[model samples]
Structures are given as structure tokens and as C-alpha cells.
Target: MVQDALAGAGYPQHVLVACSGGPDSLALAAVAAYFARRGHVDGRPVTVGAVIVDHQLQPGSAAVAAATARTLKDLGLAPVQVRTVEVAAAGMGPEAAAREARHTALEAAADEAGAAVILLGHTLDDQAEQVLLGLARGSGTRSLAGMRPSRGRLLRPFLGLRREDTLEICRVEGLDPWHDPSNTDPAYARSRTRVEVLPLLEEKLGPGVAESLARTAAILQLDADYLEEVANATFERLREPAGGGHARNDRTGIEQAGKGISLPEAALRDLAPAVRFRVIAKAAAAVGGQQPSYQRLLAAEALLRRHGSAGPVELPGSVSVYRLSLAQLEAEGQSAAAGVPREGARCGKLVFRPQRPSRK
Candidate 1:
């Protein structure tokens, strides 16, 4: 399955397996090495290597990293590298921080080795856990979609495989897998999900809960992808050009009317709610604005559809959206010229403005 996934993703001549000496990664390393030694991943010869990122969060982590690197060498993986990463405690908590740091190190290692893709060790269980967490958070469809099998330079070939399969592979290969202590630490939500929540769910809901959740993720991923494509196309159509060209003032280059996106009120009102909300969200993001909550998006949608003389609705980052008519735009221009800026404009059409520079 791993070889098939690699091949399907356009098997590169050089592949890097992210190994943590765990059953999943070890299994991946073993299989990747086997295929590489046989002169092909999906039928083409390739060079396979292993990269173990030591996020030194636990005691004896360095020793564990060394052991993992040695194991990778024994598995016939060449160019085994152990990269040390400093995990900083940031807003997302220690577990998230460690994950971020680990990924950064792996990318660097893959670049150093000239590997085209970095293989991850996430299994179906991990995908299930991720879905449950997203559900708990009440995040949108994208979160429920869980991890993709292939994302940019990262590939998770085991996403369709069970954790038990990796363990069995390790056993058959006579490989000793190091169990990370963090995997059992209840302090992490993922650990709790894996150790307690998933097991309890399996016991109560029958044996296939994890598999069912993974399937849910796979289905939602398809929906999310299609919606995103529709949203991108809609955004392009609705976005008004600036100075007869695309909006390029901001780093993101999303065309802006003023400090926000201006779309024809009719055009936006005609869209389905799913597509409408996504367009609103994309507009916010294009202007380098934070994601608006559902309520906020609804408020924006209402102004467009209901035809109200309402709002200088406040959004995150001190950004504001207002429905402006040609008359209102003329009035605001007069007010600005008269040295008294309008406080807020009535809602009739959408208008975006660039953020004003702070006075020094």
C-alpha cells in the first residue's frame, strides 16, 4: 500500500521516510527500503533514506534518536540523519509545538538530502483521532477532513492502514519499535483520544468506529476540496480590479477595493450559502484578515441579501465591511476631502479599503 501510494503520488527518485523508531515509521522505513533496494518504488528505481527528528522534549531523547537512526541504517536505508529540533512552548501547547518543530526539521532534512517527498507515519487511528478532535472543537468541514494522504511535500502512506498492520510488519521484520512515552501521557489531548476515547468508542459502538471515522474524513475531504475549488473560482469572478489591474498592494495580492473586498451585492446574494460563506471567508483571508466566525459571516451575508442601509460591521484586525452605493462612495469622498472622515457607511453595496497607515 505504501509503495502504491508513493507511486500514485509520482514516485520520486529520492524519498525520505520520517522515522521516530515507532512501529508505523519503522514499518514505512522497512517497506520503502525494500522497494528502493529492488530499484523502484512504483516500478522505478529510487534512493530511500530516513530522517529522525529529535525534539528533545523528553529525557534521553537524544539516545532514542541515535537508536532510531541506527535502526534505520540496519533496515538498509541510506543517508539516515538525526536532526535535533528545539520545541518552543507557544500558543498551541507543547504537543502542537513539538509537532511544528518536528515538521520543520524534517523539511530541512529532506531538502538537505534532495528528497522530493517526506513520508509520514500517520495511520488510520491517527486520522480517526484527528476527526474526533475536530468534532469536539466544532471546527468546520476542513478540520473534519483530517489529514490528506498527500499534502505538498509530505505523504502519509499508512493513512489507509491500521496501526496493527505496522506493528505486525515490525514483528515480521524483527525490528524493535521504541514506544514514545508521550503517546501515553494523558496531558496531551491526542494521547487521551488514542488511549481512552478511541478504545471506549470501539467497545461501545462495535469494532469499526476508528475505521468509520477514517472513512468519514475521506468523504469530507472530497467535499471540502470541491467547495474550495468553487470558492476560489467565485472569488476570482467577484474580486474587483484595482487601477484596471489586479489588487497587488498587499503581500497576498488579493484585489481589494479599499481595505476589504468589494463585490456586486447581487452577485454575492445569488450564491448558495455554502459558496457565499466561503467567498466571504476567502475575501477576509485575501486581505490578510482573520477568519470570521459563522455568525459574522452570516451578518455579512444578510447585508448583501436583505438590502439594508446597515453596517460598518467590525471584523477582526480592526477591519470593517460596509455596503456602499455610488452615492455613499461620493459622500465619503466628499467627507474625506472636507477633513471629516465618515464614521460608517450605509449598506447597499460592498466596498473594501486598504488599512490606513498609523500616524507617526
Candidate 2:
């Protein structure tokens, strides 16, 4: 499993394992060390290192980070580094903030270590839990897809392995693993899901439930990937020409992107609902808008005359979308109702623009 991941990554010169003193990450570190001793990967010379991030959330996080780094070094992994990060809520939950902080620390460490790829140790159980969380939130297909195997410079070789597999690895390797108290703390949603929800589910659904969810995620990933490619291409094609051209100097650059960007209403109306929704989201993102939630996307779709025309549908990131009215169409020299199509003609256009800030 590990070899496949390394080979797929093109056998980079250096790899950095993000360890957290947990059984999963420790098991990954051991495997990395085993590979490093070979002195080469896929006929290419390679080195392995470790980065232990201390979120400082618990009382002895620094001590745990130190111990993890020591263990990795003992495994013959070189240049072990400990990163301390400050996790701020930043309008998100503490867990999310901590994850953001952890990634930032890992990326900086990877750059400093000159590592080409950073390995994460998210097991199949974690992927199952992620899918469950996505389901609970009523998330879209992409969210239901769960965590990916490899994203850019990060790889998760352990995702195909179970949590028990990691535990057995630790036992056989005689490696002591820290059991995080947060894993059982009811104050956290993930803890509650892991402790209460999953066990109850297993009792009724059998042992294969987690594996089934993981498999489902793998399948959905393929579908989501293809649809995303289609949506990306469609978004580009459906956009109206800005300033008689699509060039940046056409006065429709990123800064002015949120100002009066238009998409053909008919083209959007013609698309499948799934593809259309994704296309709308892609456009919003092009104008620097945050990804709209599923509900927000539905609300945006409502303006296709499928629902009542509520003016100025506000998407996230201060962008608003609205279907053009007949008067507005006439103002733009578009004559659809008159049955005369001329240059720059269309039945209608959905305009996305920066919403004027409301007074406090």
C-alpha cells in the first residue's frame, strides 16, 4: 500500500511524514523508515523526515510533540522538526481552525525540509467518519466523496487500512502510542460520532459498515472528478465576453470581476441541474466568492424562473445574482421580447455583482 503511494508520487527525493504520536501516524513513520533504509524508491534515491505539529490545545501537547519527533528520529528518519501553531476560531469551529493551523505548519515545514510530498495517516475509519459527517450535514456529492487519497503534495497511504491495522502495527513494532483524551470527549462532534454513533451503528449494521462507506466514497470520487472537469469547462464557455473581449485589460479583471459579470440564462437553463449548480458555483468562485452551501446553491438556482424571482439573490462573499428584467434588457440594447435578435443578443442574462454593503 505504502509502495504504491510512493510510486504514484514519482518517488520524490524527500518525504515528510506529519506525525501526531497517534498509532496511525506512528505506523506510517515506521513504514517510511523501512522504505528509507532501502536507500532508493522506484529506482530513485529518496530520503524520509518527520514533522510533528503541536496545536497546544491540550496540557502536554509540547511533550507529546517532542516524544513523537524523538520516536521518528529513532526510526532513522532525519531532520525531524516540531512545529507549534496557534489555532484561532476565525469564524469556524475550533476543530476546523486547528486543522487549518496544522496544514499551514505542515506546508511551512515541508518547504523548510525541501520535502516533495507530505504523508498523512488518515485510516479508512477516518474516511468513513468523514462520510458520515458529510451525510449528517446533507452535503453534496463532492462532500459525500470524503477525503481524497492524494491532493497536490499531500498523500494518505494508510487510508485503505483500518484503525485496528495501525494499532496492530504499533503493537508489533513495540511502539507506545498516546491515546488522545479528545477522541472520547463528548464536547466534540467527531468524538461523539466515534464513541457513541459508530458503535451503535456497528451493533445493528454489522462490522462492514465502515468499509462500505469508504468504498462508496471511492466510487463517488470518480464521478465528482469527471463532473468537476465538465463544470469547469462549461463555466468558462458560458461566461459573457467582458468589454468586447475576454482579456484581463478588458476592465473585467479580478478586482472588477464581481461587478456586473453576466452568464446566459438560457445556457444555464439548458444544463442538467447538477451541472448547472456546479457551473453557478464556479462562476461565483471566479469572482472571488466563497463556495455557496447546498441551500445557497438551491436559492441561486431558484432565480432561473423555476421559483419566484426574488431580486438580488445574495451568494456568499458579497456577491449577488439576479435575472435581468425586460427594462434592464432594453437598457442593455438586448431585444428578446421584440422578436429581433441583434449583436450581443440573448433571451436574458444572470448578472453577478458585488452587493453594496448595508449600513449597520
The per-prediction CA RMSD against the true structure, in angstroms, equals: 6.3, 4.9
Best model number under TM-score = 2
How much is 264 displaced in model 2, in angstroms?
A: 0.2
Residue 5, model 1: lDDT of 75
* Structural similarity to truth (TM-score) of each candidate: 0.86, 0.90
Model 1 C-alpha lDDT per residue in residues 1-360, reported as the tens digit of each score: 777777877878888999999999999999888976787754677988989998888899899999999888887888999999888866668878888999899889999999999999999999999999999888899999999999998999899899999999999999999999889999988999999999999999899999999999999999999999999998887776222222223433333344355666666766888998898777767766688877887776766744444455555654556566646556444121122124322323565444443322
Candidate 2: segments with Cα more than 4 A from true spot:
241-258, 306-310, 333-346, 356-360
Lowest summed-lDDT stretch of 10 residues in model 1? 334-343
Off by over 4 Å in 1: 241-260, 305-319, 332-347, 352-357
* Whole-model Cα lDDT of every candidate shown, in order: 0.79, 0.82
lDDT of 2 by residue, 63-127 (tens): 99898888899999999999999999578998999999999999999999999999999999999
lDDT of 2 at 326: 46
